[model samples]
Target: MDSKLNRSVIDISICSRSISDQNSSETGKESHEKKFLDKNFTTKRHLKSRHIQLIAIGGSIGTGLFVTIATGLIKGGAAGLLIATVFWTCVMLLLTSAVGEMVVQYPAPSPFVEMAGRCIDEAVECAAGWNFFLMEALYIPFEITAVSSIIDFWRDDYSAAIPISIIIALYTAINVFNVKYFGESEFWLSIGKLILCVGLLFFTLITMCGGNPAHDAFGFRYFKIDPFGSGYVTTGGLGKFEGWLGALFQANFFVVGPEYISMIANEAHYPVRKNLSTCFKTVIWRLCLFYIGGALSVGILIAYNNPTLVAANTAGESSAAASPYVIAMENLNIKVLPDIVNAIILLSALSAGNSYFFCSSRQLYSLSKRGFAPAFFQICTSSGVPIFCILVVIAFACLSFMELGTGGSLTALTYITSICTKSQMLNYLYMGVTYIAFYHACKAQGIDKSTYAYRSWFQPYSAYIVTFFLLVLCGVQGYTVFLPGWWSVEDFIFYYIMIFVNVAIYIFWKVIKRTPFRKSSEVDLVSGLKEIEEYEYEHFKIAEEAQINSDTDSEDYKKKNAKEIFNNVKTWIF
Candidate 1:
């Protein structure tokens, strides 16, 4: 529902062959137009700039930040958690820049997946498509399980099956019925997420400064007392290093990057490509301020060794009182606000679940359109909903029932976090590789970077830097499983399985298809360019006409324009 490769894994050398013939072949129809934009074949473009931007921000801000930040605080302490947030935020910035450039030029269905094939290799495309598909598909259950666990904030125990069944039905109804419902619903939910984020951050700041009933002024108290944690199954510098690693992996769960935006770019049809660029540009700061600032605020609000948090972690509870923020609020005797926060956080979970449900189905649809998945998945309703893809994801939604077993939701949350986080980072890694290929291809083919629909800062350099760190992070996150007394077959599988599977898919496609790497000069930059340009202009005109008709009722044009500007700015910041 939310967020490929056609490049050779090896043979990094640039090809000397000219791709001047590429345009002649770029007549662009391997029937991709029919396969993708044929509304009968794929979904419609109803997501506006606000819808795309909010879906991404809301998706990234859910249980990972609100429900599970305590895990980071428990395992990595204040210092480790804060460092991880900052580090991942930077990675998000760099990765978004890399991917944003690609999306600007190619706004196809599953934009990056398509670009990978054209610029890199079809083999890379297939592997990327499936990895991405799995990444989003698996997240649907993880979020639903989280929704159930968040319910533990109120009830100690209930049949997780009840909520799971209800949510699955709702997901089917929304995704199978009309995409406008998806976009509009996500838009409002995202608005709620925005309000909740602002409120929580303010709550943290105020309570930390002795603004609560207790007037404790616990500013940086935890940071001073327990800056770093002694990590799992180890000690000394190694333990601290492992603590940081745990924090990094945990942080990765929250800071979803530009790829979420890329997933909905074709749908945004927001009428202005520049605003899409704005969406990409602003996302980094939004994440930085919300996530990094939240981690820092958590550190200032409470100590890592708080009794409530320790007990909850020991019991594997993902309830409201289990959250470090809620614990801090409880200690201050500020009882009602924690409940409010929890309620919003629950809505936050529902919103996130819906967005992921939407994204996973779309991603599967994208794969089907590209022929990486079965053809039946390519069939969409007249309303532009991919019924089969939605059904496929729903079929897997039953995995949420696994939350009923053993450690319950918290256990499942941890395992799924490892898989989904690394899978997301791997997608980022694929993007970096894809962008590098794209960058070189642009140079080789005499296409100036400046001429791109949008330009990201520190281009090829950002790509190179992101590539190094992501590779290191991806390989190292599973280090704990190998340590003495820490081996978990299940955790190991969740943590590292995506990496192996991603590699296997790439290799399998490369071998079975015998797909050769595209020469840098031979990349299909021209295919679909005209269609994208026309679509953008058409969307703009339609939106402009709508704006004019709406404005016709205003008694005074200047005052109305001022009010509109004030509302937009107010909404943007607060």
Candidate 2:
């Protein structure tokens, strides 16, 4: 056994001769002696900032923006929009900052999940991973149902089964290919959605100003009729307030993908810190243009209380051709343009479904790699894609088609999507807590400040604010479930069932495995300390050059030389 091990090491050295020569050339030192290496690990960095940025944009622009916000608009009137926008802005600030700080530190695959394990506790990691997996998986059916409804706009009498099948098949094909291909497809789809949104914004502005190119301007006559009346424009209780809250939540839901960018940290090139920072910066404009623009356009042109808008909201058919955008376009007499917009909605939904597939599969893949899931799911194809995990995702997505076949299709679809949102809210709250712990862990360890790429300002305060608001939203959602005669107790039961299921899973796994909670210091410090050595070694030449330029005396040079000498010695030892 010892001989075999020695032979393996010798062969690996022969194969990595180039790396050894390069290291020796830079330091002008003999490096024939081989260092120990981890036999089970591999580094594969393939993502670019463009991919990260577009993925962020794609995360924010989806069927929820084009359709679901109508429910909120119908409920809260304009105030709902104000509340949602404010809530979302605050949540994003906390999430973006928390996630941004973590990614810069460790820069790994499935960042949030790993951080949850290392920073908070292993059980928290399990909760977060499964929550993300279940939430994203739940969206598959909602997206399919939504696309099927959108397709029915033109067919009138068409059955949803045909469209649902076609959408499932297309989405599966895209995800099964490869990550780069998946990204390329997402980029183009994002472009199409961006163009469509920009066009809608400009067209709505023109119509409101009474410049119909062929008719008298509608002006703001509709606004004066009743700014908060019965439908999309109302400002009452469940009628207006609920409607706007619905829209606000739906808009925020569409933009949830920005955090998923953290999952790709291991695949990103360049300085992981700088690239992660660049990736997060992409969220600001995406929210501004997609969510804000889409909501405002719906509010201004379509009477807030339009009959069709009310019907869709009450029926939860925001997925249908009766969406706020469609209602507004049809009111303008734009010929076949409403149908065109409906087609765009279907395309966008399909895009979102593709993303859900990718995220869910990758989440499972990450879990498997960490021993939390079955080893079979860790298998990656030659392209570095997790083929087995992707197949499992597609299988679950196909199950979502049941919504189209059921009598309660609309409600079922909305419930499933709502569950997805609820699960994510739970994950966000956990992330906030984990981030706070991670910051303090560094301080306790006396880790050098300069080594950290980015620091989350406001510390525990920012995290606390985010966690508090999330709990409030959860409370609001729960309250709505039992609003006297306004809501059914069954709604509350179903919503809480999903949360209970996640907790149940965590508790069951903990007891069955008899796993004890590891202290923060005992936690695997992948980003906290282990990588510091790797980074210094990788950038040794640069550090050497920097030190040489900092001082001119031979003694200072000797001191710098001693530092590098010690680093090299430490690298060779433990």
Candidate 3:
């Protein structure tokens, strides 16, 4: 009994001393989390609701929608393309809904990566951080190279280097500056992209109804081409199935969902809960209206076997001139509009690269702040820029210069697209995994998800379904290389490199760090919850104080509330 008391006393004494020496106390399990949230004080919150919504909209409308889309139709045929898009977009919606469930609760910067570490394992976190960083950073050059393709459609006189240098310079200027400027620029860029999407859909409707010079009422004439188009590697029904699978692969690169949307959380203005909730809720329609609708319109505009599209593919051309929609416009004898479309496509690519640059840097920042990377990456500038992280990403962005070689960047764009697709696929797969673990964590901790401010339809089941499909896609994503005569060693490498790399990362970290597979019961939900709660309460108190003082701020508040409601309704319906 005396020995036991002595041991207890010694433990108490140590605890008292450790508490006094806060630095020593921080070396426990929560060490990484101790200063993890100090970034809240460092990062500026300037992105308003409109900025975030537009940014979210812009993230989905990348160069893929405008440039690489015809590649989908080329491989999958029109029907296969439409069906593939529908399949992936639906899966993405469900997966993002799972991500939304957590983002609503945390609202930290790049908090999805944090969720993986907290709910699953830190090793997974390390893998997620680096892999996600790879995808986002690489997306930068991919877009620039896409811009190279689009710009080349009009001119081959200039070396790609000059334009690439200009674009890189512009990207550097935008990202190194304040995020508010970035938000505003993206808002306008996204506005242009939205107009382009709607305009093209309208163009499809008008032209298909005999509104053009030809007055050809080609109502789903393309649908007669087996509705699924010809197959990639073979002929007949199996080939059509291959075509559909190929379209699925193409669509995989195009649809990066909630993960992209959640990147702005740390830099968004007050009332993050409402802002992120609106962002997630709107993703449903964003996918449908933009991607699925685009697919439908493209299927109507041009048959997969049109001579122009066939010849463009035969010649290995992937410029704006080769876009199915642009080809349709040219076929209809529409003169100036195709140029306009190309212009907007160029802007769309630029916006996407810019957004990716911003998100990737923040992702790196999230890693370092969480102790998964070097501490220097955690340093933020007065403007809330992660300078070191941004520099690293900018350095990667220089990969665009590789396309400046004898051949154009179009070929490089294809390979980069494949890599980015695999990275995104792994991200989606883990997002579902992280959500399931988070679901269990919520249950294990006695937290009521039913009372969440934002709850997506379908429970853990959606996660299960998405994860299974993603796994199948990841496994077979490189199957085309195995097809007879379709073999290319380079294609195989770019296609499946991310999968191998992601596994290697997880294994290496697990072995070296000895990071335990954290059980759901041991997840750290409370670590960041208090900060978010404090943020929300501080916001609430300001309003309460205004009301108590009988300031006109109360009336302003009501007006703002009414405007917010109207905006929410408009956003949902649109």
Candidate 4:
């Protein structure tokens, strides 16, 4: 092995819950011990399984799938459905496996960037860190852009600046309260979204069962009419494949955030290995329950070519007729409820924004801890919140409102959000490579199997398979770039900018500051979780033992039957 690699490998073994020794005055946080982290720097583990599950569900239900999938359906048709599903399935598998490997092995904050530091070059680590920050930071603007677009439901004229300011204020306030506050907020947000989805599903079923008030119980007939009469609306034809492919691709991107499961590594009460194992197993179910159910319901109830799904009607790029569910209700002559459904969609968007803000702040904190970022980011508030980082994230999100004046609101949002999405994929790619290296290092060091909290079901093969999928998706994006006006050069501008910007920053800092990438030994894995698992097991074990003993026999039983109780006591003690 190279001398540098040797140093990193050795560092990994001796790594502890301490930051790089710096003057306490520099960080502005309290002193840190070698074992537990500084109290000023610790985050609260307040998130529960409900918080995690709903966040996952919230991730799956985004505007991308709720509104944007119609565009993909327009482009690819029924065939597009299969393509989008397959592509996303592969993406999800790759992300889950790679993230699963890291969280299981390290279970720390900012696992993506840290893994980049380990598996690839350090330059890549810095790149991944900022890339992730940029992705989340930019999301603030993209989401605000949607808020403005949705406002068009009532007003023809809209101003982006006002809503942008309001969103920033809202995000900052919600995040600064405490981590649990954020969790509770997301829980309610997910509930609103789920109710909307279930309501839509019910409307679709009512329509399908031949109960339309206006259109003669149309059943599957309007699906053929093309409400707009632009032609080519049915799902069965060969010519509609491209339309579906486009919609499917968009759906794949929309459903990209479910891996938010990994973010809870520090807070989840149970072992990460156990929690993540349960999470990964639930991944397929999440996909089916949210995306499959939501999409199929929309497609069956509303025609693909519904004039409302078209971009022209909404004054933005194609959306599923605002809330396509509302359009279907209107088509069926159901009044007094479309407005309510629209309100629910608005809340869902906010919920997703809330999720993005939380994850982005945590990512910032994690990056700072590794010396990949400045120590200012390491400062946490009394409630274990990263106040400085939270402010910075809200600032970036506000900047994303620049798209409001543009004509293509949805397209603009899509363009910016796509960059963030692709950046996420880039992080996943590096994660796969990192896990491969981590796996080999463990083997080479002859580390015992017991050390790993959770092992990926299939080892090197699964890793390689996920890697191949990532490469293909990356290539597909590149190929899409050269296809004339069919693809937007501007949509991808952020992708290149993010990569170039990160590289420049890394090279400048590395050369001047003399900060070189360390070997695996230098990496710190135990610091993030701070031995929460050990604490839980040690403190909880005795209670568990007593509970088991008490469940079988009590003090009254012992007093009532001395001989029998004495025999039982002897057996228990022995």
lDDT (tens digit, per residue) of candidate 1 on 6-36: 1221112112112433553477646544453
lDDT of 4 by residue, 128-246 (tens): 77777777667666666666566665564656577767877888888997788887788778877877777677777777887677645556564454422232323444335434444
- Pitting candidate 2 against candidate 3, the one with the higher TM-score is 3
Please write out the lDDT profile of model 3 over residues 192-241, one tens digit for every residue. Answer: 89989989999998998899998899989987776887676889989889
lDDT assessment of candidate 3: 0.82
TM-score for every candidate vs. truth? 0.87, 0.80, 0.88, 0.77
Show the lowest summed lDDT stretch of 10 residues, model 4: 226-235
Candidate scoring better on TM-score of 1 and 3: 3
Candidate number of the best TM-score: 3
Better structure of 2 and 4 per TM-score: 2
Which parts of model 4 are misplaced by more than 4 Å? Answer: 1-39, 155-162, 214-245, 270-273, 312-314, 317-321, 400-418, 446-455, 478-481, 484-496, 499-530, 538-574
State the C-alpha lDDT per candidate: 0.78, 0.67, 0.82, 0.63
RMSD of each: 8.2, 10.6, 7.2, 9.1
Worst 10 residues of 2 by lDDT: 32-41
